[model samples]
Target: MCNTVKVSPRKLDPETRAALVDIAAKLLAEHGAEALSTRKIAAEAGTSTMAVYTHFGSMSGLVREMVHEGFARLERQFAKVRRTDDPVADMAVLGYAYRQNAKANSHLYAVMFGGQSLAGFSLTEEDRQYGRYTLLTVIDCATRCIEAGRFRQGDPRPIAHEMWIATHGVVNLELGGYLIDPANADRCYDGMLSSLLVGAGDEQRAVTASMAASKRRRRREVEVDPEPAEAVATRR
Candidate 1:
């Protein structure tokens, strides 16, 4: 008779140092940072409480790392945004990416910014700059459109802030599951963007011109790379 071999629950590699860090993050994600404790994390990881202190120094140390990691992820995501010559389109893409990230990582967002501060946890200057970078991406695009005679000549800073608020509203609602009909999201966003840009005749003209320039640029790029001869002939 052949005997069946029983497989063991893959014992999480017993690297106590890294194990504590990961366990702490998992606890923070499930329960807010305030609920996180060195003892709980160590117990969850199947290690002793002293292991956490030895690895992270204290609960505050663990929280600091968690906060830092959250911002770092946001920074990395924004950094990967492929730069395009058309700043407006780039801004739209960045905004969309921001919402997607927030939706996917709601726990990270709550831990990082939800006003429930853990003792000894504070946003570092670099952490704050991660947020600034996101805002700057929007402002840069708005400025480019204005300078190229697309958008009206006005300070882009306030406009960028307005865009952030509009995007944030949709994200907050969607994350809370308050927005059930997905179709309504696109309509709301489009309307908000249009209302934000609407202005005097001259400003409207500038906006139209900028959009035209962006389209022309895209067309020229496409023209530079012609389709395969066989594909074109097949269409005929």
Candidate 2:
């Protein structure tokens, strides 16, 4: 029998850990989840195969981290969105940011939702719940709108969820290149968000005019009046 060659574990640090995650994400996007073997990821990151085990314990552990990283990235993107005084307008900005992040990280976005690619990995309920925190940004906005007497009085989660569902569906289609005229996707996305805002009881005429003014003035990117996000990622 031939002797086995052992590789020493690479020194783990914040930078290295992040690099590994980024590399893994790229590999996942380029080759699909099945091709995300630890060996391949480590080699891409210029580390030994044992580094994966050292840093993340196992391939399954690394996949778990990948899911968490995707959600975490979204949280950070949405967190940067300016929460304008008008909760309805702010909600629209959040939707825009969501689409931007999805487009920028299309492959990771696909892997996050399309779990079929990683059929061999076993995910826990908690793992499935990892990204609920990001969804809360929508719910919190809906709550603000309701508190300001914009939406119908009730639990805001379901209503916000509908908005999220609509937004996600639109983004999914856009990313999948299903939009006939992708050039006009921005208009379509904005219009879709305006409709969702109206569905949540925002004044239809006001929302429409405000969105129009926003498009003209380009002041929509300035963040304002958003709820605190310090504890957002920690929430279930």
Among residues 3 or more apart in sequence or in different chains, the pairs in candidate 2 whose N, CA or C atoms overlap within 3 Å are 82-223, 82-224, 83-224
lDDT of 2 by residue, 80-104 (tens): 7666667776677777777777777
How many backbone clashes are present in model 1?
A: 2
TM-score per candidate, in order?
A: 0.64, 0.82
Clash list (residue pairs), candidate 1: 150-206, 150-210
Error of 2 at 140 (Å): 1.0
Error of 1 at 118 (Å): 2.4
Question: What is candidate 1's lDDT per residue for 1-236, written digit by digit as tens?
Answer: 99975433243344554455545655666776655887677566665666666656777776666555555655555565556665665555555666656655565565555355675677678656656766787787678767765567789888788878888888888777788787687556555555565531125554444345544443333222212223332332
What's model 1's overall lDDT? 0.59
What are the runs in model 2 whose C-alpha is more than 4 Å off? Answer: 1-10, 213-236
Error of 1 at 17 (Å): 7.9
After superposing candidate 1, which stretches have Cα over 4 Å from the reference?
Answer: 1-26, 32-34, 45-51, 54-56, 120-127, 180-183, 197-236
